[model samples]
Target chain A: MDISNLLKICIKALLNNKMRCFLTMLGIIIGVASVIAMLAIGNGSKQSIRAEIGSMGSNMIMISPGNGRFGGVRQSGSSMQTLKLSDYESIVRQASYIDKITPTVQSSGQAVKGAKNTPTSIYGVNEQYLDIRGYEIASGSCFTESDILHANKVCIVGQTVVNELFSDGTDPLGQTIRFGKIPMKIIGVLASKGYNSMGQDQDDLLIAPYTTVQKRVLAINYIQGITASALSEEYTDQAIDEITKILQTNHNIRIGQDNDFNVRSQQEMMETMSSVMDMLTVLLAAVAGISLIVGGIGIMNIMYVSVTERTREIGLRMSIGAKGRQILLQFLIESIIISVAGGLIGVVLGVAAAKIIALFGTPTAVSTFSIVLSFLVCVFTGVFFGWYPARKAAGLNPIDALRYE
Target chain B: MNEIIRLEQIKREFIVGEEVVRALRGVSFTITQGEFVTIMGTSGSGKSTLLNILGCLDVATSGEYYLDGVSVRQMSKNDRATLRNRKIGFIFQNYNLLPKTTSIENVELPLMYNRHVSHSERRERAIAALKEVGLGDRLTHRSNQLSGGQMQRVAIARALVNDPVIILADEATGNLDTRTSYEVLALFQRLHRDGRTILFVTHNPELASFSSRTITLRDGRITSDIRNDRIASAAEVLAAMPKEEEE
Candidate 1:
């Protein structure tokens, strides 16, 4: 009737069938390990994404043009050229929340160097754009406002472009490079930035002044996208709001009419990415939960077999004056001990599993919360699965049980 | 003499798929203090069922069974278990010792249910019981490590550890050889002589001769109840009985 008696009986029973008890605990072990490992992988991926998004300037915002208008026909946003230089100038002058603004005009062309020519994108922007988008000059000085005013063809090249053209890691500052018959002077080399989430070649770009791009390279008065930085991180929302209102009024669009452009902050992008990662983690956790359920079922099945195998023992205890509750408690304690012990072992295995996967170049981080949750899940499985078998053993008729062969 | 146990019209019926099987048919009996009583019956004569009821391991279908002035039939299931723990000890044919437990631990089991007993006292009593059964040297042996006769003696020690008012034995010597059974019976006789009330169930007539009183059951009813005023000691009975040749 006392807990110590039940504990002693449980210990003896489990020790008697050490192999079976270990095998039974194997299911729980796999269950907890899988749950922990899967959650770690999922959470690690989420953290990776957040870090990636954070590397992009938190105060930065991107504005892309909307679809072009036609007679009863709509065009894709990529085919539109609704953004203009005046809109960029207006944002800089009229929007108090905007700290710096720049327009981007992009085109792909072959850059000729000695005998090597490589096809790559040429992006046009001002000196402020480099600071706004979190860039630093590795070598020579960036083109200043005087360069933009003079409509200079001076350019800054990405590290990959420099590597491709120079090949010897030579200082290519103030050198001449030709893009589609337009020869330009390389004033600076942009610092190396790794690939983004979309796997874009961030350092394989060539930068030129917006005026030169519009007048000579692309030959269009409209810009493709506008990049801007907020005066402060706290002012990003205000900056985005003021830009939207200005663009909407400049385009002369009525209420409820589709705007000609879209404005988005890095925070919004990070939030959207986090939600996607959250869904992914939950999905992985759910899949792992199925394995835990299977483990619970295994425990139930094993406990039933154990009760049947120990029928005579149960009867003997009853005859020796163990109450129904005592029998129930003994069996239940046996299962709980197995499950809890398995849970502890599984925690170690799961952490090691996560670390191993991480060593193998997979993103995985074991969270303390997941460990506690997995351990609790194991205890729950013990009680849930051990209940029916314990009850069956407790309810056995002493005469029949003692007589069981 | 105080009546240690009484059975008033104890009737137990079994239900088997809408058919009723009468295991015990209105059997009534009384066992006085310090009396060694044996119930003799073949299989299915309800002697085992009677023993189960007397041990408080089974409830009768209709009965007014009393032990030491307490009505067992009306006691709650937990109370019945407590009564079994405090008032009765059971010995079985197969020894029913927990296979994983040492002899000393097995003897301490019943006392574990009685919280009022101190741990040292329980251990002391268990050791004393082992000593009484001539098993003081084998206290640490598991059931499988002991011989058939030694295992039975250990079971007896476990039964007597609590010093219950009655020792209920259901075919205590059924699994033993002739020599071992005689040894166990002699141990029982010595226990009885020490003023312990004992109720032993066995179908073996030769084994029934060792008890002070015998009740025979036939077809779920008591066929004969007789008191042997001059019952011989188990040693005398064993010495006179014909021994079987060794295989």
Candidate 2:
């Protein structure tokens, strides 16, 4: 028999039992819908995290002091004080991939401006710190290079600091805010960055020239850390490598010796986070795959019942001239039609579900790859599960089947 | 006349729980084209088994059973199926018309298995066959909507639509009233008169008079095979009977 006629016969048979066919398709529908929705949710979270990391800075590399050994006991990384202004200068002057570099020192203190007072961390950095950290000035100008040379007491205040130290109606630019008995003039207001992934407030900080904070507040000659930005995100690894080589030679560290400084790139963090997200997405898809198998079993069960119930019909068809393979093909086509149709409907339902999830403020990304993959899986499920029942039908003896009233 | 069927020492056996029950015991027969023959027997007499073998639904255990000069015993299962499709048509006792299907579509069933038949040709042949069986006006009526006699006529149309070499009917009117049975038998007589080969199997001895030849089976063997010179005309009997009120 031709494929068109076979399809017609299968369709007619299915339509004769409309309710049963629809119920049989329900399992597949739910399976595919959940698969798509789960993967979308997983992919959406991954995208959001990547965007968050991107906002921090894609090409930014940080050089911090490594752990120090005192009395044969290892101290924390921050307490080492191994990074210095000279090391930062050597990197700035020697590294070819470096775009912008800055030395940083940090201290926590209370900022008091007349009646308003708030506790916040004060960061000492040059103007390049804003470029490396992807920060923009909201209002007022940043301090100049001359400010660092003169050791001027000018700072940039974040939005949270502005809100805390100044009244709602008062202007904050050029306002002098005292930091633990040291008053500094506010040169600019940094752009408002809402929060990090960890729910920490990002805009509650202050920025000043490193020389001023090192000389006046902290009273230290060595810098705490250095931040640098590469020419582009692709050059981050090369920039880190060049900075490490320059630092190693400047510190006179020979080969095979542990360096006193650590270079970390945001790109590395992005790759690690991406891999974790990929794993989570695969895990979710695997869980959803279990439901698909259950759905396939449902198809198998129904097909077996249908073959048993239609034994006489099979006999009649065989008597008329239907070959065994023709009967097998007929049943197989029926199952495939059911699953593929269910898969298409499930795709629509899943996309709608994703949109509904997005409305609830969770990110959802629907990828074409997942849709196509699920469709292929549905086809395979139909073939794999429909095999046994169709074979049983085809192998039936016509004489016995006809007598199977 | 061309010999349409030749069965030589055909035997069939069944292994029924340690007992080898013989269904056919070396029965031999030959049927020619344009012959109307009847094989009559009671239950357990192997007439059903004979009809199954003749219809190509079952293979004989040991025999050279030739259908239209081709040895069916040597044919593959699929080849036998093709031969059945090309050469034989069957009318069952229950009519076996697919319920909830229209008369024309039921008639189109056999042709659907013929790959050489185009879609339009199938419909046209089905319509022509139905018209031949006096069901031209009820082409779209579902089997359930038709009377018993009408349903049997639809089955006859299905058997005729394939243009096979012979029609094998197993107790074709076993489910009908005497009046309806005579009506269907009259149609078969008409087809037989039109030079169609037909093999009719039935337990009713009264139906034997409607065929030109009658064979009797007893104990898995042919008890008698005789030609009838005084065959009764079903159309004449149906016409002479009293007419009943239509429902």
Candidate 3:
């Protein structure tokens, strides 16, 4: 028989019971839609994370004090304070790949500004800390090198500190805020930087000259950490290697001894974060794929029922000289049509769902690869699950089938 | 006349749950073209088995059967199907027309399996067959819309559409009333007069006089095969009977 005639017969048979056919296709629809929507949501979040990390300066590197050993007990890195100003000066003078470097010291305290007190973290660093960490000054000016030399009581405050310390319509620049009875004038207000991927508020901190916090507030000479930016992203690894060697030499650590500090780059962090996101996307897609298999089982079940219901019709066709393979092809074609049509509809629904999700403030991206993959999977489901039932229908004996009530 | 069908010692056995039921036991017959033959038997006489075997819908356990000089027992399953498509037309008892299908589409079903017939030619031949059966005006009517006699005419048109060597009908008029049965039998008689070989299987012995030959089966074996010198014409029988109201 020609394919057209076979298709016509199949369409007619399916059209005989419209409700049943639609119910059979519902499983496939849900399967494909979930697959597409899950992948889109996963991909959207991944892109946004990469963007957030990119904004934190791709070539930036950080160095912190390593844990110290005292009396056979390990002390935490924060309490060690092994990082020093001499080590930072040695890396700045010797490292060729490093373009910017700054010593860092941190202290947390309640800042009281005219009876409006707010608890916030205070970071201490040189003027280059803003450029290295991709922070911008929205208003006023950054403290000059003269201010660091004099251990100036000047600081830069982020948007969150501004909102907490200053009332509405009141200017924050040039205002003095007391940090544990040590008042520091705000020289600049940093621009807004929203929450990071880890849900940490980036704009809820303060920046001041490192020497001021080291000499006046903490009274210790050892620095807490150091931040630096390489000349370019490509030179970040080389810069870390050179700086590590310089620190090892300056700290008098011999060749066999472990260094007293840790060096980390933004590139390494990006690689780790992206790998975790990729694994998550695969996991979500896998869970959604289970629905596709379930949908295939639904198709197989309906096809079996359809064959049993149409036994007399099969006998009639066989009596009219329809070969066994022809009958198999007719039913197989019917299943394939149902699945493919369901897949097409599912693509539309999935994209719409993704768009609606994105509109509600969650990111979503629909990729063509997922669409094509889901469609191919749907076709495979139809063929794989449809084979057994079609074979059973083809193997029916014409005489017995005709006699079947 | 060419001998279209010949059966030699045809035997069909069914293994019904370890019990070998011999449905047809060594039956033999020969039928030629243009013959109106009837095979009659009660319920358990193996007449239905004989008709199934003759129509190529079943194979005898051990027999040598031929159609138009081709050995049927040696033919493969697919070859048998092809031969059935090209050489034998079947009319079932219940007017087995496909439900919800138009009359012309139902008649065109047999030709759909024949690769040599083009699409337009199949339609033309189906229309001609319906016209021959006096159903030309009812081509578009579905099977349920037609009367019992009209449905049988549509079935007859489908059986003739393939231009088969012979027509095998299994109790073709069994479902009709007396008047409707006579009308279908008259149509069969007209076809037989046109030189079409026809075989009608029925258990009603009263219908035997309508055919030119009668063969009776008893207990899986043929008890009698005889030619009737004076066959009753269905038209004459209808003329002599009183007219009935149209149902």
Candidate 3 per-residue lDDT, tens place, A25-47, comes to: 88899889999999999899888
**Under the 3 Å rule for N, CA and C atoms, how many clashes does model 1 have?**
0
DockQ for every prediction shown: 0.66, 0.68, 0.57
Please give the range of 10 consecutive residues that has the lowest summed lDDT in model 3 chain A.
A66-75
User: B42-110 in candidate 1: lDDT tens per residue?
Assistant: 989999888888888778999798899888887888888888889988898988888878999889988
Error of 3 at B44 (Å): 3.6
Clashing pairs in 2: none
RMSD of each: 2.9, 3.0, 3.4
> On lDDT, who's better, 1 or 2?
2
- DockQ for model 1 equals 0.66
lDDT of all predictions: 0.88, 0.91, 0.90
What does candidate 3's lDDT look like per residue over B129-176, in tens digits? 999999989999999899999999999999999999999999999999
What residue runs in model 2 are displaced by over 4 Å at the alpha carbon?
A: A67-75, A93-97, A108-120, A159-171, A178-182, A191-196, A215-222, A241-261, B15-20, B144-149, B177-179, B233-247
Candidate 2 lDDT over B1-247, as tens digits, reads: 8999999999999899999999999999999999999999999999999999999988999988999999998789999889888899889888777767899988999899999999999999999999999999999999889999999999999999999999999999999998999999999999999999999999999999999999999989999999998989998998888888743
- i-RMS for every candidate (Å) is 1.4, 0.9, 1.1
TM-score of each: 0.91, 0.91, 0.88
Worst 10 residues of 2 chain A by lDDT: A193-202
- Residue-level lDDT for A9 in candidate 2: 90
Cα deviation of B193, candidate 3, in Å: 3.0
